[model samples]
Target: MLKVQEIRELIKLVDQSNIEEFVYEHEGSKVEMKKKAGIAVPVAVSPSVQPVVQEVVHMEQKPVQTAALQTETKQEPAAAEAEQIDTSNLHQVVSPMVGTFYQSPSPETDAYVKQGSKVTKDSILCIVEAMKLFNEIEAEVEGEIVEILVKDGQLVEYGQPLFLVKPE
Candidate 1:
């Protein structure tokens, strides 16, 4: 059985970040959550507890709510801060082997990060599928993805510029 404490923790996690949805299901228990315009609605389904359903009531508070949420996110922590990237001279992270460079782990999934995505030194920029093996390509430097030089599922050559990053 899922407890109220667990639900509260989930709500706290949602409040602390830009994540829009949280869903978890295990052993006949399911919890689904959605946050629209800074209001979170959580629904939990478990065998032993009665269901709690809440209707989404959109009020005439869009501008105020969005601004408040934005302020809160900025004040909490700078998770999405754009690093000071020197774009005048862009650095290129080249592929080490000949393979198909995938922007994502799977075809049906979204890219690991989009252009203008800030990355740390150890962030995986993309994946290279070669000889039936999928090898992850890591960013050699901390920067923002200035340009994607290769398309998804495109065959990339050795030492090719899979992406161009502007270093911080």
Candidate 2:
């Protein structure tokens, strides 16, 4: 069993991590935490899963299985179009948080970045709205936008590949 303060700290860790869910149990007491809009939401304890404190790590990211992401019109994972893009020379910039993806700052504004657009490490490539806060997603690596794997206003999952970039 864990104390309230310990659980709270754990919640903060999970909320800030790339992992989606966490679980901790000792004897009879159990606690679960899942990220929901930069806040840790406690989940009702269930007997099925086993994890002391599940932090959402990027290693566990799986492209959400959805037809919208599997289309042939330039909206699939690099693996789906590997032969066409030559991913060996590209690196992916993924979503750091789960939220609504917005390509442009506003409906009337131009997109922050587009295909063939050059980007620096600090470029604001997109915005992710979570918990009513518009967080700017930046390009951590300099590159040219090779492909956008998602559409505007789509519900993006944590660690979802947002753009495939070819190193400059």
Among all candidates shown, the one with the greatest lDDT: 2
C-alpha local distance difference test of each model: 0.69, 0.72
For candidate 1, the 10 contiguous residues with the lowest summed lDDT are 52-61
How far residue 110's Cα lies from its native spot in candidate 1, in Å, is 1.1
lDDT of 2 by residue, 36-90 (tens): 6555676755443224223332222333333336655554455567557777878
lDDT by residue (tens digit), candidate 1, 1-168: 555535544454564458888886756778777786665556454554323222121222244467668956664222233234444588889998876789998878889989899998899989987656789999889988887766798867678777778888
Off by over 4 Å in 2: 1-83
RMSD of 1: 14.2
Error of 1 at 135 (Å): 0.6
Query: Over the full model, what C-alpha lDDT does candidate 2 score relative to the true structure?
Result: 0.72
Please report, as a residue range, the 10-residue window in candidate 2 with the lowest summed lDDT.
Answer: 52-61
In model 2, the number of clashes is 6
True-vs-predicted CA distance for residue 34, candidate 2, Å: 13
